[model samples]
Target: MGDEIRTILEQYALQNAVKHQDVPRAGAVIGAILGKHAELRSRAKELNAIIGSVLAGVEALTHEEREARLAEIAPDLIASMHEKREKSSDLPPLPDAEGGVVMRFAPNPSGPLHLGHARASILNDYYVRRYGGSYIYRIEDTDPKRVVPEAYEMVREDLEWLGIAISDIVYQSDRLGIYYEYARRIIGIGGAYVCTCEAERFRELKLAKKACPCRDLTVEENLLRWEQMLDGTFIEGEATVRIRTEIDHPDPAIRDFSAMRIVNTTLHPRVDATVYPLMNFSVAIDDHLLGMTHVIRGKDHIANTRRQKYIFDYFGWKPPHYLHYGRMSIEGLVLSTSSMHQGIADGTFTGWDDIRLGTLRAMARRGIRPEAVRAAVIEIGCGGTDISFSWDNLFAKNRELIDKGSDRYFFVQDPVHLTVKDGPEQTAHAPLYPGDEERGYRTITFNGEILIPGKEMEGNDLIRLKDLFNIRVTGENTAVYAGDSLTEIRAAKGPIIQWLPPDQTVPCRILTPEGIISGVCEAGVAGCVGETIQFERFGFVRIDAVADGCVTAYFTHR
Candidate 1:
């Protein structure tokens, strides 16, 4: 029984790690163990001991090593895992999930949605889809200073491209009256008060753990002040409504926190309203009204969660279940919206869709599919640990999703003319999608001259022209036909290079993260706009445009 249990523990630990790209938690391993071998559930202590020992050994191995081991012992597990990956995700069951949970993704309409935003939105949408419910996309566009006029539409486009089917879209700017009504209710119940203290004085009083003199004002006076605020008598920054909390609370920030404040509504891009609810208050009200069962956000919001809970307690509304994920740092992605915004304003970046940015449009332009983004984040898992994102892992996920579907083409960057001295003028054929003959071949007729990438002729050594004859570099600028046998090249282990007959070439430029690469490709590539194709020996590129005999593309990954 012990040996059998040890095998189960080892297998599941490796399987879990492979699924999540992280070390397996003992809880998951135990669940898998009891799920498969019910008889083992009786021996909890024995199973847990085996799990701890097994996980320690598995955790020591690198991700690659664990994958290799899983493949060796249980290739079936790897096969099914991959097949599962290409389709819908198999996310863990949501805790306390009832009959169809309602979730919401509230993004501030200051910029396009980014990867950091994707985690919360994607995870929320994924759960709603898995459990059968509604996913709300709410635009938290209250701050006139941060709101971008174009960002409202940009956010919609980005989310549409990301494949998140939102059940409804709500803008907070349009719901100001609802917020005002709630603010009035909280005031009427004495849970809040309108204060006219100056900014400096209020900060001083809050620091001293004492309330402003206005805190004890009659509800009639507070209501009159609130009306004056709406009537514009109390201009911007003159008065703010503070939620009544324990004034002497230890944390100064939590002491009688401001819930509503005056804003320059005339300058607001979306709505004209003088009074605006702070994030905690507005979020608490919207979550309750929108029927959000769960709130998935970063761990930085733990303090914000406590602040919002105070509002829920005051109103007797049940707060949504909060799942605060830890911060994630993808090595090469720029997740900071403010930095990207500033860069765009100063002309440091082209736009939100620049390949250099990490916005969803940028990823999409580079041939990173929405499904790939969804899969990568789902595998990263919603843990509280700070994890660094691996470009290799993300690329691997994308490659798996796209490899079989992408057609092959040859791109000769910095074309160096190669002269085949003796080979016959034959029409060489290659399958558009290798291994799938039904798709058929694209024919390239070779007379004598062909174009190869400049790097291919750097050595002036012998090489095969891939699916055609072999050639030996006889000079700095040329290669001569040496032989035409596959076995001959295989014996010498010569490098196989991609070549395009000059007559069949079209001018091409690839937008890459490093820089733009100028090249020429087979004429068939001109029609690949809106499609991602593999440039044999190079990487996959998504064709963006074709204008005046020039093809424009963006490099995806190797």
Candidate 2:
């Protein structure tokens, strides 16, 4: 029992340390052990002894040393932990989730799906899968003036990339008749009124807690006006159908909200109807009709929720359960769709897939795996508190997912030629991935001349050419052979610098967040278009294109 407990503690401590990049806490280790071994609950004193012993061993080593030791003992632990984290999300289970739960991701096709939009999509997809329910994809493209025809396909592609399967798809544009029928029913029941008042007048009445004169029109009169609205009798913005609420309601905006209005169908991307239903009206009708049992959206829609509840009450229908999470903001990013569109149009941005943009398309182009985004958002769960995090948080998650697969290569920007005299001619073999021997190696022959980064050559009289041999920098741009002794090299503790044979190199350019970095990379990188690899001591980059004797890649992160 003592040996088993100690082993478990060591594993947990290494896992905890690697995950947080810090010393493992004694309390956390004990809790993890207790969670996995409930039978040890009564043996708290014994477990603490094991935990303390393990923590002491871990704390005695430096961060790098701890990492190296953990890698040696538990090579697969980090990947296993990632799989566990992905499986065991902290999101709370839906209340009373049982049979036949239906959910939907209804996106307005005004622009491409950004990171903020992805959160809602991922949450809905996750819960639906958890409960063995149906997932629906709906495009709420009712606002013609703001709709982008191309965005419809972009949304589909984005959702597909995120691994969200749509069991059913719906477009609000095709449901105009359904909305019209419901609107007429509300009008006949005296629950809604047609108002022809100007926008300015309606604002005045709403602010002053007064009802428009048209609010008291008889049901028959409103029905006649509704027919005129559908018959092209009402020009755009000439009239609107408003749902009636208490005039003295504390929230003046809810005094009487517009249920449907007139928009020029000619301007719309898909539909050809003069009268269109607004979001609150269309969403309420669709949620009830489609049998959606739960609705997940941002808290910014709280007012919309209240308005929809009124519509449900008027129709004697039960509203779906609502889960509203707070808004999430990416540090140093303006996630406004309008701003992104304008920036792309004006050449301020290269395109939607620009590394600096926060759209899912951009993230994908930058080699950020969709699984990483899903896992990060799931870790956040459906909290009501606003989430603010930097890009580093996202990159940290991505690094774990891609680290094992990314092959290593040498790239030197602003190359400084170094000539080594009296050096033996030999072929240097570098492994594609460290500790992954089965992946094989990339070979480069050196004739004693190489190109290294100018910055790395500074203040270093003695340096090791990584995976090859040692060199002593005798002058500014020259070097002499330092005998091939790995022990002496390690004892000296010199900086290990990446080098590329001058003749076995290819022109390369990296698009970093700052700007384009032009350089030369090892010849092995020539055929790896669209492959993500690490530029040793520089950063991870995704090869975007290969053309014109040059390989172009987008820098992901360090």
Best by lDDT: 2
Candidate 2: 10-residue stretch with minimal lDDT:
57-66
True-vs-predicted CA distance for residue 228, candidate 2, Å = 2.0
Per-candidate TM-score against the hidden true structure: 0.81, 0.85
lDDT of each: 0.84, 0.85
Candidate 2 — number of clashing residue pairs? 0
lDDT of 1 by residue, 326-416 (tens): 7888766666889999989999888998888889889988999888888888887788999887777778889878888899988889998
The parts of candidate 2 lying over 4 Å away from their true place are 1-87, 390-393, 485-493
Per-candidate Cα RMSD to the true structure, in Å, reads 10.0, 6.6
Kindly report which residue pairs in candidate 1 clash with one another.
none
